[model samples]
Target: MKFQVIRLRTLLLSAALIAALFVFCLLGNRAILTVSGQLQQHGTPLILIDPGHGGEDGGTQSADGILEKDINLQLSKKIEALLHARGLQTQMTRGEDTLIYDAGCKRMREKKVSDIKNRMAMIEAAPDCIFLSIHQNYFSDTACCGTQVFYSPNNEKSALLADAIQKAVITAVQPENQRVIKPSGKEIYLLYHAQVPAVMVECGFLSNPEEAAKLTDEDYQNKIAAAIGDGVCNYLNNKQS
Candidate 1:
């Protein structure tokens, strides 16, 4: 009986030690997560997402008739879902397919001007917001493919966001893309006028038959948007840190 009791006592002591170590590990992990999170909020300004094109503004289309506007809206919505899951604040330029223009003139130039005004209004409303405009590229040269991130020449921080996003794009999808983050001049009206940190992302080339097909696929679109969301999250968290 004495021998049995000693064995039981030893076993109990060992179990107790194991439990205590487990608790210590759990607490240490929690502390690490907390500290890392706090460090990431380096400078979390608001974020405004612009889904390029709308209503009548059906941007570049695939030969198959898929409108770039539709693709932009879908991808932006997906990004919004991911951002919301991470507890990040985001604002989209337009949620629907409706035109930014009220009506009357349907001229391309007139409508584009009105859209620019609306986009600027959104940026002005959230002066401190980081701006992101989602778009797809189309060129006569089908060879030009892959995601390209462009920053406002006027804002230095915009370049950071562009680089961060480009890194994510290359990492997630187009690993072969050689194009780097470029500056948007007068050709991109919104980037020129945006007062906040701004970047316009060309998710892929619509002119390339294969790329166009991929962009139109719902699953592929989700992947693209998710990659973008992940990049934005990393950038914002790092900025805060």
Candidate 2:
């Protein structure tokens, strides 16, 4: 009888420990979920993604005929997906390979101006938003390669955003990249006029054959998007902290 009582006490103690462990795990998971939800609800900033040129304006072209507009849209879509997965809010100036110009615009130049104006309007419409424009770079020399970032001069925070993206891309993929972020001049219409924090990512030089090949690759574009996404998230988190 004494042995049986001892065994029964041991069984009771084991069951109690298991019950306590289950409760602890349940509470821990709930705490994690709550923190995640809070960050999604309050910590994230609205990101306005503008994929550079489209339609008649194909921007730059690779030696193999890959269009910069197409690559920009593709990479922007990937970045949008990454941001959404992280529970962040995002809006795109153009989702398809079409210009966001006013219907009244007729000539090519007029349409181009209208498209840029409309994109700027979108950036201004959002409250406390971050503007990220994706584009491909080109130079007369094919030797010029690697990603570069440009920031709007209107806002001080734009430089910080640009630095984050430039560093993130180099650290994540192009370890050899030595290019630094530059301030946008009047030449870049959108960035020059943007009132909110804005940065344009010149993803790579389409003029360079080797870089062009990598830019056209779907896998490489995804990696670029992921790095940009990480940079945006890191910037926002740091700002919040």
Candidate 3:
């Protein structure tokens, strides 16, 4: 009778173990399915637009004393408006002319690191957002002028987005935009590290006298914005298809 009891206990223990395993598997599967469905729902994608330089940092300047930071902010606002018009949502890193990020107290490299970390944290909070940085380029060579789009090296999808934007600029705004879309190498810190699709657009070169004049023109700015809007529209359409 003692041997019989031991065998019966062993059978009961085995059944309990099997039951626990079945419950665990059921819960795990339900969790996985729920997560997968959430991902599909949130895949609409948000665009994080970062306008380069602000306040103390004036970025590149033009002959008329126009600051690159101001131009960048203006362009970014235009882009945001254009995107909204198409029912797309956007978030700007700096909505004003002054500082948005704290550069820290110390002047050491750690301060810079802290600044970057702060920026990264802001970015990380918006995981579904892709990135677009707006800036104007300056070259010692005055002959170099035209819009150039650069994609993040870390993301292959960024290359396609850059290409579409470049095409839009060439077809809609400047028929002679021979600059071409290229991959960013060592220029932007955010683009270098982003796993999301990201690109930096250099609207025009301030060094070129004529281009500088055009960059400051209100009508010309609208044209540039329209081109970018068209580019983004095309990209989204293609993605959906």
Candidate 4:
């Protein structure tokens, strides 16, 4: 009888130990799955900064000969620096005064097309990223001079990002600016077809003498860059929240 009691106690203890281990493993797996899900949902994304117009395509030009390409590159570089200072990863489409086109492209038209195609390929190749294209605006009236943001229609988050940038710029620099964010149309080749979140910032109108002068100023460029960087950071923080 004593032997029988001892065997039963041993069996009960073994079963208890097995049950405890099973519960522990189940909880551990749940914790692991939770962490994995969080990482997948809120992964850090690459910031792809594209400076519009380069090489032969000078884009819009100010009356005083301020090339749009130069201003775009300047602002893009400043913005990249600001973002980097805040510990964000960024990549520029063109860091120099050259076009990114395929070899063997002899004509201007071919080069422009190739350059755009290559940029699009870069956007698509990034597994997870945000596209920010910098460009200057122009109008025949010459009086239209305020920053505008256009967002991609392909991604739902694009509108939020655009709004954040618009508001940030308005609040930080152009307090009188009343321009709102707009949805990018077919005319914008990159934003129109981008599968990921994309936005084009028409920093200001080069046609307007006042705005053109400001755009060329180093201090104003820094302000614009800081505002843009803040906008991007705000968007990312809100997304994580």
List model 2 lDDT by residue over 77-177, tens digit each. 99999998998888789999999899889999999999988888888766467899999999999999999999999999899899999989999999999
TM-score for candidate 2:
0.82
> What C-alpha lDDT do the candidate models reach, one value each?
0.82, 0.89, 0.79, 0.90
User: Best candidate, TM-score-wise?
Assistant: 4
Which window of ten consecutive residues has the lowest lDDT sum in model 4? 32-41
- TM-score order of candidates, best first? 4, 2, 1, 3
Q: Which regions of candidate 2 are displaced past 4 Å?
A: 1-42
Tell me the tens digit of each residue's lDDT in model 4 across 88-191.
67789999998999999999999999999999988876747789999999999989989999999999999999999999999999999989999989999999
Model 3 superposed RMSD (Cα): 6.3
Model 4 steric clash pairs: none
Instruction: Indicate the worst ten consecutive residues by lDDT in candidate 3.
Output: 32-41
- Mind giving the per-residue lDDT tens digits that candidate 3 earns over 87-206? 766778889986454645455454445555555665666665667888999999989999999998977789888888999999988897788888877657877887778888999988
Better of 2 and 4 by lDDT: 4
Superposition TM-score, candidate 1 onto the true structure: 0.79
Better of 1 and 2 by TM-score: 2
The lDDT, on a scale of 0 to 1, for candidate 3 is: 0.79
TM-score of each: 0.79, 0.82, 0.78, 0.83
